[model samples]
Target chain A: MDPSQVEIPPLKDLTIENITENVHLINSRCPNPRLKYLMKSLVKHVHDFARETRLSTDEWMAAIQFLTQVGQICTDVRQEFILLSDVIGLSLLVDSIDHPKPASSTEGTVLGPFHTHDAMTESNGGTLSHDPDGEPCLVICTVKDTSGKPIPGAKIDIWETDSKGFYDVQYAGRQEPDGRAVMQSDDEGNFWFNAIVPVPYPIPHDGPIGKLLKLLKRHPYRPSHMHFMFDKPGYDHLITALYLRGDPYETSDAVFGVKESLIVDLKTVTPKQAKEYGVAEGCRLLTYDFVLVSDEEARSLREKEAMTAMEKLGLRMKLLDGLPVPDVD
Target chain B: MDPSQVEIPPLKDLTIENITENVHLINSRCPNPRLKYLMKSLVKHVHDFARETRLSTDEWMAAIQFLTQVGQICTDVRQEFILLSDVIGLSLLVDSIDHPKPASSTEGTVLGPFHTHDAMTESNGGTLSHDPDGEPCLVICTVKDTSGKPIPGAKIDIWETDSKGFYDVQYAGRQEPDGRAVMQSDDEGNFWFNAIVPVPYPIPHDGPIGKLLKLLKRHPYRPSHMHFMFDKPGYDHLITALYLRGDPYETSDAVFGVKESLIVDLKTVTPKQAKEYGVAEGCRLLTYDFVLVSDEEARSLREKEAMTAMEKLGLRMKLLDGLPVPDVD
Candidate 1:
């Protein structure tokens, strides 16, 4: 302990462990125990990642720049960084571990980067596709409980792309919500609608996330599909999409939303059956059944839905209660 | 399974559960298993947090806004968000769990948000405080092994504030790296320098971190302290700071960098002792000793330092071997 025995300090020997240890010391001195623990844990992991990788200065700066671009790309309509999470699979992993669904229900998928709050409601069997130039098609679906009983008065919120593979929102000027509709089923748990067969398309690629994917040598296409969110009381809510069979990107969906159970056959209908469904002869007709799980599964689904919504919107705890709800449009 | 028993789709009952479950299903279809797992997990946590708090649309947007601001505020020199992490203690927590330093050497603390690479090197007994306008004092320190033997030829990198409590970096024009020095210990593990004692001061408050603290109703002051990073061949590197005794903000240091063992007293020197050390009579002197652990500890310290340097410089693995080191200003 003699003052004469003090050694001078060295600079180059700086390491992650020392940096983190210093950070921990600060954490231990914080006034709030919870904040302290939280900060300490975060610093430790971040530093560890840096140390394990032997991260270089340029790489660190690049990361900082990537983060900066992620912020800049965020706007009211586009959340490319969140989409980055979708592509990276961080979002889905969180969803699965937190929302363990029952075996009887359909699996959930990502709420892709492009979900808006404004779709016009329509009567049962109403057409979501307003464009006459698109290929004519009919969609018939059955809603039932896990035990095979029909669920009366179920609702189907549906959306799809035009034949050109563009959503109404994507071509705001050209389309008037052409492929978006909300319809309620009748007493027989059946729902039918007329629409155009959606085509496969590429996600917007002008942003940083797109650039990153390109850098990674990945494609940016999603298979043709119809988005659906089905709901009935006492049954698990289902947010799902039906992908068309034989789509090229089925296996390499840019956002990774494809499932074997979700692929459906679009059958060429006869003129007689077409007349009955109010569609022209040779039009494609697609039919599928959506089975809802029990009450417990339904609850989990609800929890998962809430979590997904929050994450997409990037809602933090402090702003949860008093912030105004964003306009769905 | 009869077609006649199928129920129609319903619209009104589409609860949050359906939305979440649907999202989960799509997530499971990702091509890369790792990406799928990560996305699911992130989505689940985000959604759960949202649902648990009932976050509204506005609240969500506000969060997005906050994150955006966090990104916007980051730059080459100022990293307010990182400071936020430091204050919140995430950085430290991560450090501790990653590098469990043995209890022999000085415990680590946070590397304050502001540090420059170009510190002036000084010979033995060289004073860092060129403008000695504050509490005039002599700093005497020693480095020793666990057995209390001197560690010969150790290096000590030291930095602190002037009597007015301002680092050289804080005032661009006024200081020439004053109050910062790199020196080597003699054969006896002893190092001494004459300087002015630093006073407590406020961290910069013009940036986003300052704005956030203000929003949270918190102060922005750190206790007076001298920074030290000591290293020897056979022992662990020591990254530490010495807090001034009786500082008003010791308990509430903005970045929480106070440690009980690191605090030291500034004693007034007698006329006789001042002459012996060839200093002015009635000057003040602060003395402390640094003890280093074995080689393992030193290796950990070195690792942490390298990691931090890499993080600061933004280096990556691909560039490490052939990359040229940046010129330190």
Candidate 2:
């Protein structure tokens, strides 16, 4: 590259007051408008955060080391960074912002770190977990649009911990997948399955994130919950969870995943209801209806949100010339 | 622990607008005042950044993955996190804010990852490197206070790239150290040594930060320079580097380490000067002085900066409530 053609700001000797301007000027050369905007905002916030903290060298170095540890402890099945983000409330914030919905549609929550693509595929009324220790549960759920029309063949994936508050994947040398599986709704937009009532359990907190929780004097337990994800062609995909009612950790969930609309109650199965569902003598029951929005509606809502944010910033800013124009705060 | 004993807000089912508030409320329980402030500011900036950019789930996940890779790639020999911080300009910002100086005091810069405490100690006029392929240069430098009183017995640590634009530690299977060393000044506040004239080089790319630089269309080169550190009891420690005058990359250092006052010139030594310094024919000469501030003065400046920052925030906020009150952007 020619020295004369270099696009970053001609900032040679950066001082404390000028470093931020230099960074912004250099980023002004980015060709992609969206990326340029993201980078610019990121730098401004980070710089402001440091200055506001008056962060010392020792403290700053400690943060660098902490991030390094969070990265180093990650493995194929475990994600320490995601757990960190969840504990810090970032995952939930992003989820809520990205997946806005109407009052009638089901709300979305965090897709906790236990999700995996290898769950066994099953059909309605089939068993999801076969642990002898867990009490049986019968799930009766349906898929529909905002207007209540049945939408058949919706894919539903569910995963949760066993009665012991431990997912099968967390066990040492685990032989097979348990307490988690995938199934599709029937042609009548109804699906039912046999599983256990999941209890509240602690997140994986033996890593740097765990250390951080201890430092903050906060516990590391998430509320009792059963994870669910729904997907169908021409409809928005929903990643949400159902928190069992009366759980002690419900209100102060470490990840803040619980919602008033998502908290659900379970009932003792009657004899007739048990026979109809082909469940064992002692079983609990859960009934729910998931409402989804059309693809066009979801896209329109996203655009509306972006426009609102832009108006809040009071910018009629045109991004077509390539470099983003968001001023440093 | 009893459910009623939890100190965080009794917030359940958080919404987009409420999530930030919930985070701040929960963090209000921290016992350490300083940590509470830092975490509060950090979350605000991060959340504000996400909202301002309308960050999508896909982009957020991509960032998580990028940070994970950065951590995974690190080992005893590499520090990718520090490199990341340096390139994004946070390291320099923190350094400058933490170490503000008057006009007469020397400025500090990024302490790049090449620094290690193992450099061999040498005396004045001794050789720092034994590379047979590079031209030799003699350094004549002194340490003093802002009042121009020479400070004797000051410690100086110097490190630089060889003529090949590589530090001694950059090689594979290398035996002895080269191009870096540590020593002290004599009673007269002067120290001199022989070493190669370092050239410009690129930072460690080929990782996430490198990929980011490429995406931003930014180069990875820093200008030719030698690193210097001065230390003494009751005086502020200085970590800085000296840029060679007229280097092509001078104006666009990748790490943003170059400053006009920190850049210096080198020229051919006169025969008498060469004889006095006991240097071989054709060796170049570099002469400079480093000024430091006392610990008391440094503390006062830091307090002033923090007060100014507080004023900018319009906060006469008291931190004794065991909670920090920095507002979310």
Candidate 3:
């Protein structure tokens, strides 16, 4: 197509009211219908946010600069954008919509910025924490289905902070992975790990997000929680964390990742039991059950929940719904 | 405030339906009312977008990584996020809202990604283009109030692409400015400069945003144009661009920056006339007039435009309106 053959919007017609429409007009040509809709919805929401806030030019530039800084600081070990999404609750919201279960099946939560993939693999009853400073915790979990069937050969990736409240990756010149490991569920669907009792710790606030939270007079802290990610063939992967029930930040997690079903108490275990559990003194026990959802069930549930979510949000979506939803999967 | 004393949303109640509310509840503690409102609105729209799209986990992660790459690619010169905003028409929408003018005054366009503060200052009728490969263009403009009275000593910063459609800054060499210069309007509000007739050019496409445009089957080319930024004390600073009328990308600018009023035709100047303007052979003359708005007038107009914009966007605002508009200014 000859570019000049396109209809041009006259300057007089490019008023603040119609500018977004004109933008959509140009974007309407996108060949991929799903991308077209995504762009349309994304642009509409973003523009609405700007107009609703009457976002000043300076503020917009500041946002651009802030986002740039967030991106620039990210590395293989660090993802500032994830931290941004976490602090703003976008991560948890996505987790809820994309991978969530309720009732007998366990629900999901934010994967968080501290998760890593290079964890050491171990069999059942593995040790995940190397930090001796933290109180020893024996974590026991059963991988099961909603019908009470054991999910054998399931892989569980878990990580947590030491007493110092820092991930091994957070340290300069990190050596081997510490406070993190992957373990497989036994034939009977049981997986246990001798680990440290994760404690409440502040999210890195020394970065731009920290500065933003500081400006808002908001603290940057996630409640004490050990991260867990479960995966198995034919079952929907679960990305979640178990919060320490009595952690100070439990109710006010900076990332909003806490949930009642996901919070568990840390029971103190005697030295003898700790020895039996193969953990050091000052021991505790963390226990929970993860009921995995099948992929088909998760798909149906996701579709059903999406329908309910439209009305639940109470956000204006009639216009967006009017647009065709391509195969988003 | 003690976090434990705070109310916690029970996991049963923390269904997908009420997660947003819980987030808002947590964010409600933000002492800065403006920041609180901003966060509230921002999170609402973001969550709405996610739910409306039923955005997949993989897609969401892709966006996260995309945004991160955009930020990391930015340097003192490059700003991928700004380009992202520009292509999405957020920049134009913000420009229309932030510093726009209507019938009597000059309407603003995007400042674009090429603008820099290090232009070499020149006198009236000075030359701005040093690239010998481009056809010369003589640019003349007068700065005046809406009443058409001359506003003397106004500063005009102008930049444009060379014949090859590359900004001086885009060159690999770390050299002096080539096609950019600052000029002072004369006592009679007349400012003239010799420059190259800019050609249509593609925005930097090797970055994440470029990849996105490619995925959407959208081209990255912006129309040929000259950037002009005018500033004077007590007057609202104007950032705008004048597009070449017949450029192939005129009607289909990638950034949606082409406006009818800002488009000007370039007339060829005779050899002798080119010398009179101190421009190279095969010269083209570009002419336009800029009408400035004083700070008082601009603020009033901004307020007026903002009110109309709320109605024009046709986005759901009733719910957003229920929230108190803290002193944003």
Indicate which candidate wins on lDDT. 2
For each candidate, give its TM-score against the true structure. 0.56, 0.94, 0.91
Clashing pairs in 2: A259-B13
Order the candidates by DockQ, highest first. Answer: 2, 3, 1
Question: How close is chain B to the truth by TM-score, in each candidate?
Answer: 0.72, 0.93, 0.89
Candidate 2 per-residue lDDT, tens place, A215-269, comes to 7888888888889999899988889998889988878899989889998998878
Q: Comparing candidate 2 with candidate 3, which one achieves the higher DockQ?
A: 2
TM-score top scorer: 2
Where does model 3 exceed 4 Å of error?
A1-13, A270-276, A279-282, A310-329, B1-13, B270-276, B279-282, B308-329
The best-first sequence of candidates by lDDT reads: 2, 3, 1
Residue A176 error, candidate 3, Å? 1.1
Each model's total of backbone clashes: 115, 1, 0
- Model 1: per-residue lDDT, tens digit, B1-329? 11123221211112344535444554454444333433444455455444444443334445546667766665544665557655554444333333335556566666665655667778766777877477777888888876789888887888887767677776755435677888888899888887778788777677766765554445677778888887677765566788888887766666656767778888877788687778888888889888877776544554555456556657532222322222234
Identify the leading candidate in terms of DockQ.
2
Predicted complex 2: DockQ: 0.58
After superposition, candidate 1 runs with Cα above 4 Å error:
A1-48, A54-58, A131-133, A162-178, A298-329, B1-80, B87-245, B248-329
* TM-score-best of 1 and 2: 2
lDDT of 2 by residue, B58-130 (tens): 8889999999999998876578899988988988988888788888898889998788778889999888878
| Clash pairs for candidate 3 | none
